[model samples]
Target: MPPSESATRLPPGPDTAVTLGIDPETLETLTYLQREYGDMVGMTKPSGRLTYFINDPAEVRRILVRRHVRYQKGPGFERVKMLLGNGLIVSDGDAWRRSRTMIQPAFKVQNVHRLIGVMIGCSDRRAVAWAAAAERGDTVNITEETNEFALELILISIFGDDYENRFMKEGDNPFAFLSKDSTRDLSVVMKVRALRNLVLEIIEERRSRNEESLDFLSMYMRATDKNGEPFSDEELLDEVMTLVVAGFETSANTLNWVWYVISGHPDIEQSLIDEAGRWVPTVDAVTAENLTEMRYTQQVLEETLRLYPPVWLFTRRSIEEDELEQYDVPPGTDIYLSPYILHRSEHIWPNANDFDPDRFALVEGKPRKDRPYFPFSLGPRRCLGEYFSFLEMKVHLGLLLPRFRMQRVEDDDPGLELAINLRSKRDILLKPSVR
Candidate 1:
């Protein structure tokens, strides 16, 4: 079969070379392409690699779920690989499969249930700090506050006792830089290397003691493959680093946006508070069951993710020929799917730019499959920490929102910063007052 005849022709795109990297300009270019060229626009990179911007819902689901095996993690991950090594986020093929299998057991709902106390504890710390800030009438930087809360929660979940006794005492937290610094320069790489070595040291110490514990590290240490093999030290280090980076960033960014969005919509904020009070009336009442009962909070989080998905852009490369809707995706073609673009597309979602949690409201005997929302993504490769992150966010919001009311310090919108993670360009400050 000849190259042109065997596959359907590519969709229409601009003749100008498009440089699709992790930057704001790339997002603007993508938005323009989608607007001008319709849903499935095709382009050639300056290097002559074929690229497709898939905004159609059916096609997006087909690429991510049904035909996932025909693709691999594509470009733009070279920078991520520097930080995460070949962990689950950047790893593909048998390596990803093997690592995912070993790590899946550790994230089971039962296992995650054990971490609720830790979530409450992290939220309580935030409450105490915010209470003091409210007393002093100071504006709270919700961005940095969410970052620290998520960082502390994940660290405790991953390290347990060592989070305090070992990791903290090393002066400043080596992992804290991952949250603060978004740039993936040489300096960031060096810091990642240092953090990796620190994690490796912890692994070695844990192995030496050979005692059983309940943290992620302990479970991962005990997890064995179908062949009864454990992850090598380097492999374990990469996986741990992946967990920390993946676990912390998404929840923190979403919560930061939640506060900003909630402040603008007082009616929605009161609904969340009422829902939280009904479910979790007191700190002692916080539990996995109670948190799950706060259905309105979940909807609010879902709507937030729909608007500000942390991973705004995702790229993959087709390793083999595939058919998506009417278009034929030729082998070696690069794929671009932007949740941020698709979520806000006026065609797919009516009034898509509006912040409406009711879009996710549950109706009796109604199904939600038709919605084109996948903030944590879909398919087997979907994030394993999705459940954990949701629990953490819910606990933080459900417990904290009831006691404190936050007013946006500034009326102007905090514009988006399109990077590897979608975040507010400036720190969002809010005035917290006791309710």
Candidate 2:
């Protein structure tokens, strides 16, 4: 039986029905509501649907981790569904569980560790470009560069040889639009669907060849559920598209922010360069232990994620009635969790807006409850690529920062885009000079 809505005390909120979305206006509304009403603000939307903006870290943790089964992927993901289909990020219930179980093995530590050469290869590709720009005294469009670096890295990682022999023909990658356009509009969705057709063709080609490769596609193709059933062609395509989008954007956005921030803080950049010097002094020296031992670099990335989580907002819908703190969450209620808002909450973090990496210094090996942070989110449903993401970014900075010095062009602030993924509104320009 579900808890009765009438039986519990509702949290404070505005009397008039409010509107919410995955936009700046929606962010403003949530922030204003948090300020006006406090941590848990319950409100009726214009559609008369019940919604709660949950800022209380404990309660947010409970809903996302402990009581997660009572919820389904919610409202905002409709936008994503157009792009990714029913892959892991937007799926719910048994479908999600099955996909997650099958796909989990593909992201295992040993598997990710094998891809170090690919990571370095991608960085090397960027190095060549940055070096050219430096020789010509050009300012690099950092936003575009990170986008290319991450997008190319993910493509090559997924498709292996086909990325060059197939997609990179005609001097243009077929998947370039994905990096160039942030707007996931109808046309973009159509392009993604078309790309899935390309993926479908590749799957068929691989199936016919019965060949193995060291890439995500090969791993995903080999994954099986408990029943030993491989993913269906449709399922394979959805997961492939999911992997493509999910694999790239987080790293791209984070790297963009990382470069932008480091340029503004030379001391931090020098600290990162110094750390890279000791652990990853040369390309050949980068090892599993080296990545793990780069403590200061890790702190810098953690602090950057705190200020600007790639996916700034997360939304979910309650399946069954539930309780969060003193409030009763009735079935069919919408739930909102914003890492952007919570990470910057003044109460929990003193001088929260400041870019200080020391706050995360004490967070190493700490208990789950001790930290109120979730840049990649919490619990079982948390991002599968968390470890892989950190390593990729580390390799990117560790290798490149020591060889080149980059500072913001004209010292301009690249304000945030703040859409589905938090990105710089303006393409951040950086003047690069080889060290």
lDDT of 1 by residue, 1-435 (tens): 112334467787887778898789989999999999899988888888888999999888988999999999888888899878999999999999999999999999999999999999999999999999999999899999999999999999999999998877978887888777767677888888988888888888988998899999999999899999999998998999888888998899999999999999999999999999899999888888888787889989999999999999999999999887667788899999999999999999999999999888877835377879878888989989999988999999999999999998799989999888999999999999999
TM-score of each: 0.97, 0.97
Q: Which digits, one per residue and each the tens of the lDDT, describe model 2 over residues 329-358?
A: 888999999999999999987899999987
List residue ranges in candidate 1 displaced over 4 A: 1-8, 365-367
Over all chains combined, what TM-score does candidate 2 have?
0.97
How many residue pairs clash in all the candidates, one count each?
0, 0
Candidate 2 residue 427 C-alpha distance from true site, Å: 0.9
Point out the worst 10-residue segment of candidate 2 by lDDT: 1-10
Where is model 1 poorest over a 10-residue stretch in terms of lDDT?
Answer: 1-10
Global lDDT scores for all candidate models: 0.90, 0.90
Model 2, position 373, has a per-residue lDDT of 90
